[model samples]
Target: MSDNLEDLKNNHQDFSKGSLDSNEEKNPYVLFGRWFDEAIASGELEVNACVISTVSVDLQPSARIVYLKEMVDNSFVFYTNYSSQKGKEIAINPKASMLFFWPKNERQVRIEGEVVKLPEAISDAYFESRPLQSKLGAWASHQSDELVDSSEIHNRMAYYSDKFGDVVPRPAHWGGYALMPQCIEFWQGRPSRLHDRIVFTSFEGTWKIHRKNP
Candidate 1:
């Protein structure tokens, strides 16, 4: 590879000028919602897309982009097939991280937490809320598994289409996951390179707040 390519690959995105003042009176959850609302108002694409990072039993790491569907009570929720790579990773190691960035607002949020499966009732409720086509696709796709041809998927969909023309039942393996945050960090970008970072952490029954250098 060229030296310029290597240098570019190693470069980091500099964020300057943002300040974090935890004096907002509201909790981190509320603050997050406020920022998210602003992001939506700013017309950012895929405001709900977040980077989910998981670790395997062998200590390897993997990550992917997934939609953030709900913020229930105090946790964030999303759904997927329980048999996928991420699913297996969480099965063995429940520690995970989620990152959200809104370029238009020059804001970023990072969450590190423990992963826990939502109650069956919650999962079932979200599953039932999905569109019939999504439900059918869920039943048709094997998720992270390999497929020999596109025909297999189409065939499966056809079979499901004939089997249930109007409505499709949610699969037991496809459901929702709740990520309970142990630490949450909010970042805002500034003019030069000095950015603001505020982090909130939970311990026992109390919460602690801190500021970190950019």
Candidate 2:
């Protein structure tokens, strides 16, 4: 290593939290649930947060952080404005990917799949569960759109608050999207930079598992 980067290059951590065995859970969802539970129990902040990537029709890629709300029908679920940049991109190209990293445990998961809109009833139910202010925000924010000033959002929030009074309805432009994953990969960090990687892919309604070099 160069002398200028010698100290930085020498800094490393020995990841000995856990290991991935071939005999472990075969279903990716099962494995994900186990790891997610452990993350929560370990006091990881924002454990449900993940980065989602989308590509527009022009082939430009964009990524943003979103919270994973639930796992339903073998898919990962999250909510957002249907008119947002990511939503528009997904409309043109349904293919998307999600990534979850837990630095404390030195683990990561990658999910790739096509996204689909959830039914209106499901969105309604989840919306009702949100706090009052958040419900108001859903109606106030014209997500991904240009705003003249921050005060515009406050004005809209005030308008919606007075209009809805106590019961705020979910906006027609807001709902949930489900990512039906075709491939899922799990990675575990280890000492000496020799990491463990396992990938599961879907084929003919069945999932096939494979180990990957890392």
CA-only RMSD, every prediction = 2.5, 2.8
TM-score, candidate 1, is 0.90
lDDT agreement with native, every candidate: 0.88, 0.93
What is the clash count of model 1? 4
lDDT of 1 by residue, 44-89 (tens): 9999999999998889989999999998779989899989999999
Task: Give the number of the best model, judged by lDDT.
Answer: 2
- Return the lDDT, model 1, position 35: 89
| TM-scores for every candidate against the unseen true structure | 0.90, 0.93
- Across 1-214, the per-residue lDDT of candidate 2 in tens digits comes to 6776877767778787888975698888899999998888888899999999999999999999999997879899999999999999999999999999988788999999999999899999999999999999999999999998999999999999999998999999999999999999999988877888999999999899998998
Candidate 2 lDDT score at position 205 = 93
Candidate 2: pairs in clash: none
Q: What is candidate 2's TM-score against the reference? A: 0.93
